[model samples]
Target: MGERRDTQLDALRAVAVSLVLYAHFLAPGGTSFLGHLGVRLFFVLSGFLITRLLLEARDAAAFEAGPALRSFYVRRAIRIFPPYFAVLGLVWFTDLEQSRSSLTWHALYLSNFWYALRNDWTPWVLCHLWSLSIEEQFYVAWPVIMLLAPRKRIEAITIGAIAFSLAYRFYWPITAVPALARDLLPPASMDALACGGLLAVRRARGADVPRWMRRGWPAFAAAFLAVVWS
Candidate 1:
């Protein structure tokens, strides 16, 4: 079971990271489509793992709530922040003599909004790290979701996902508010992550294998290929 979980999780992440890298390094025709799908898959995967971890915490006797929140952020920081700051340090060393601005805001995760506001902010090397900020913000708040809410309330998580995913679409002007554009990762981008959380909840209860999903994987695959061919 754990092996299957790891495989699917890796598959989902590998799909996103591969597409994002391709979109950056190569001029692939399907990059945009694949990138969108891949990013969504990442978010879904995140939700699934986060939900699983929270359930484990909920179930285990020694699992305190503090670790639930702390370890989540710690693991996230270890995975992301080190290389991220290294890039910033590297960039700062190389090009301050030629470039127009300082590295302050980018370090602060405010670069996205800064550039969006100034209209002068061109792309930089560590540009993709902006998504990391969004993910971190999600981590910071997601644990509380598990903390306050009852385990049986599955729709609560799903509704939260729906609300978040739909928020920017409904409130674009507010979303378009650009001061912290980098900080504000679009809710839609997180839809897949939330889907993963839902799946996690399913997994804990043996509901992980949705009837429709189990029944339809083959059909879905065929239809997906048909759509691709057409």
Candidate 2:
């Protein structure tokens, strides 16, 4: 049977997917609030789940960095690679207009950076891959950090990353940098993931969340409405 916690996560995932679908199909115009909220929810959930798994592995009695890292990578590869490559193959075979060079970016999981550099979206077939690239990039760096960082310091590191992401997003446009750099790149959006990681770590440590905070659904609902109506 699946863990009880997974039931809550599955419900959250359903809600996130619904919001994304609603934003895409029903909402008018660019960057709908629901879409952004859904994407953020996905990021947070990804961070939480990945961090929790890594922590569990580290705490295992037979933990060895080499074997553990290899195992993690293998599992991720098995889970993510086949379908991803199949889609890329299909796109390549069918889309004569797509630049051969652009395929390199997608293959390397750097489609987000490629689009950001050009300040244009990839063809519809690949435009949505940017978020996948961001997550893949995160997967590359996060595991190493989690494996090496001291337990007490991990929370601070995650917090610092979140702060940096927020600052980068807020300030990037003001600078002479490219607009898409902040808009599409992982650095400017890492805060959502970091927030999730922070929560996971705290929960793993058995930190007591206040009852008021635990029951703050009204606040979230109000915020959601504010975004939707804004």
How high a TM-score does candidate 1 get? 0.73
lDDT for each candidate structure: 0.63, 0.81
Cα lDDT over the full model 1: 0.63
- All candidates' TM-scores? 0.73, 0.87
**C-alpha RMSD of candidate 2:** 3.3
Among all windows of 10 consecutive residues in model 1, the one with the lowest summed lDDT is 221-230
Clashing pairs in 1: 43-192, 43-193, 44-192, 44-193, 47-197, 48-196, 48-197, 113-181, 113-182, 202-208
After superposing candidate 1, which stretches have Cα over 4 Å from the reference? 1-5, 28-31, 96-102, 115-121, 170-186, 208-230
Off by over 4 Å in 2: 1-5, 96-99, 210-230
Clashing pairs in 2: none
lDDT of 1 by residue, 117-188 (tens): 664435555455556655666777777787557777865766578567655444554545554342245463
Best by TM-score: 2
lDDT for residue 145 in candidate 1, whole number 0-100: 81
